[model samples]
Target: MTTRRTFMKGLAGGLAFCSCGMLDAASAQHHAPRRLPVMVSGKRIRTVDVHAHCLFHESLELMGDAVARILPPTKGQQEHFIVVENRLRSMDAMGIDMQVLSINPYWYGKDRDLSAKIVQINNEKLAELCASHPDRFAAFASLSLHHPDLAVQELEDAIKKKGLKGAAIGANVGGVDFANPKFHPVLAKAEELGATLFIHPYRLGELASRFKGNGWLANVVGNPLDTTIALQKLIFEGVLDKFPKLKVLSAHGGGYLPSYAPRSDHACFVSPQNCDPTIQLKKKPTEYLNQLYFDSLVFTPEALRHLVAQVGASQIMLGTDQPIPWEEHPVDHVFATESLNDSQKAAILGKNAAHLLDLKFS
Candidate 1:
């Protein structure tokens, strides 16, 4: 009979709240801060971050003179160059027990041979790093997605041999959308292998000019929009129907889709001409969300609650676009969601990720 409010009130004067120890976010910012573990209803919980970004130094070498083309070894890209112990400490402070490392694909435009070599090297480096700290890290394999045939083999080798969890993909490969049938073979392979494809949003490219002024809209607006377009293409073009079991998880709460997904449900009804009469979708546009998984990187309790409202909590998992510093306190972010019960909080923290990725931890 105990309500969630009183249950939270029963804990540490109702100030420590839901066990993430956020008691005072303001003061904690200035202080050394707490390295407390995440707990729900007095029980400790494991936290798995499915969206932490990383790039290997050796992989950068493949670019040679063109290394600066995409990432440029910026201060952000240099984060992993430090000792791994430092990263572990950062994870400890943030209450993350495990992170699934991923590298954003930059060689999507590179030639097939060069791109394949880059993927092979990066996947090896990722596997080595995960091998070093199996308890603290797992990784998604890098793939030469630009070439569908090579990607099929790369994914198999990375998962079957290298022991990676899955693969990280940009919203689009070069300018091509996932809906393009050319990539169907890779999607089919992923479904057959049950490999989760983590879709991290990337730059908007051609759309950058409009997002010019302040606020980094180029990223803030563009990245999520990129993901929205990618997901929509899969849904509207019948790609999801072709490969219903394809495991896809999108970063930043699957972009703006969840926010305005219902709007899409009415699109085919509102504008009959544009809705393709030849290809009928099996499910309502919004219903497609039920099959998709998303990272909890929306950045606010209310926002997360809304996302969960749209797509059940079972479809959400913890993520921090780490090293870039998008959501530093992801544990606190989960604990702060008033609408979630302790069970749901624990699931979002790590249980769901473990189930989805087949991860194991003591």
Candidate 2:
């Protein structure tokens, strides 16, 4: 019989796990073992993609003409979210048994009424999709950060009423960094409810001029930089202190922060006058990474290895940025990380996400 230890090892460097999720170890032996992926005792390993994206075409109506310029047209690739079978096929191909769906905020710049309606529709659809395929799909609810009080209710409703896994938010609302005290109620509710906040970056805003000409530098450099700035604001301005237990997961492997965090440990010291003494941080800047979470979207095994070294393997989870192909061979990427042993690989693959999101295998 395959023990949990050996099965997880198989997941890392050998065979893949179930295409259809397997049950808990305590009950797996009662049923026949599925050959597609390995099982421990009776439980099969799970592969979850936490950085997948989706959009409700109907919601775009609210954007009116602005979408043509503001949004990338959605027609290029046939979407997996529209066809459940297609998503399952894609997931099976990538060795991702499940994907946690999210829609990056397009409503951030819109007025309150418009943003609220758009968010309502997006959250309802996200919950609907997850409800349709509980095993193969889950989602983070969309929020309207334009109104923090409203966002608080949206988050509560999403988790408690709709059963979404968490809330997906942009790194900043337009250009307003989340560290501003205005957004605290939402953070407080998330901490109280133990909801994971998935931070995807967008809108380089003032930096747009510098990124004007290039090989998609707008996204290539902007996304990660936006995320890094957002995180730094929270850390430097003491937002993390106010809500120490916030379950924040940063996309794009936590942007550039994990790669260059220790430098922040020195910023306050090198320029002591620059940092506000009134806002005292509980830990060194780099140390806060231990309290945060990231994805495995960083490209190379070496990059992945470095991220693990900087923020421990437990802080990283599998992310594909799926439907966009930022990571086409995600499963292989994790298995190829020479620095990670089976347990660390297993944790990064699905265990960390399962624990962070409180995923219940069915």
Candidate 3:
């Protein structure tokens, strides 16, 4: 039986031939090549990016002088000014069909009320953008986890009322780790609603002072480490067991979990006393890693290949972490990866995301 990957490749080839109408000429060409084959399934596979960020002008206005106060806008920091229109242009250039717009979690500070307001404004704008350009955009609602009740209210409003596909949550909320019982109600609500939760990392303010001299070390290294820690907490604390229906999509390819699963499993087996009693997992901690979704932002082909091997292509989707310094050309990056066949590449580029987001593209 042909796998999903092979079937997609065959479909892509058929669509390409029907559209081009020069299969014989293409096959006969020896010296120079004509148009290359489309890399994904369907005639126009909606490249639904599960992870793309946008900051509206209103949000910037809300920030008011705070933006300049935090970090002066420089050449490389142009994405800081990326509004909805600017993000749309970037998506067009990158061949992304619909972007699942989210706001970076940096704006959430300790003040619960202020964070709720910020999330409200950002999520409303995101909803409006998706409504206005239904073909070009989808959205993931942002929540103020600092205020769980308000966050849950906003989530219900966004999904049931605004028709948002999912939500974007930070690894931690005002220094409170996500696995803490305080956040269980929020997780349960997400599971009940059947909404995906995209987990992004924010710079741990408490840890930033420790890396005073290293520029971006707190963001680059600290952020992924924070993700690793938060995920492990959720697993070992049995949060996953409580809400097995929760659909989580982790950024940066789930940080170090895939690489460090063996050690975690060994520790769990060898020292049950050290492991949390709440964790009643039937398999190793790493086995549950496949239950979550991941983005194709691992940077290198080898890394992407390893991720596919570990989690399989169906759980992988395209993500650019848009308007961020770490963002790469997602389409080009996947195309260059020699390890994936045409069909697997197509799935990562858009098919998986389209299915996850419940997007309808003709």
Q: Which candidate wins on TM-score?
A: 1
The lDDT ranking, best first, is 1, 2, 3
Per-residue lDDT, model 1, residue 199, is: 90
Leading candidate by lDDT: 1
TM-score each candidate.
0.89, 0.87, 0.83
Taken over the whole model, the C-alpha lDDT of each candidate is 0.83, 0.81, 0.72
Better of 1 and 3 by TM-score: 1
Q: What lDDT tens digits, residue by residue, belong to model 3 across residues 1-362?
A: 54444433443343110111121222233212212223364454557677776665455545544544333232224454345576666676566777788776756664776666677788888878788889878889988777788778888888999989889888887778888998888898999999899988865778877866747577667878878887888777788888888999988888877666667778867887887685577666777787889887787777888898888888999887765534435676676678898888888888888888788754
Where's the lowest-lDDT run of ten residues in candidate 2?
14-23
Q: How many backbone clashes can be found in candidate 2?
A: 2
lDDT of 2 by residue, 166-259 (tens): 8999999879988789999999999999999999997878999999895888889999999999999989999998899999999999999999
Residue 157 local lDDT, model 1: 94
Better-scoring candidate (TM-score), 1 or 2: 1
Give the least accurate 10-residue stretch of model 1, judged by summed lDDT.
Answer: 11-20
The RMSD (Cα, Å) of candidate 1 is 11.0
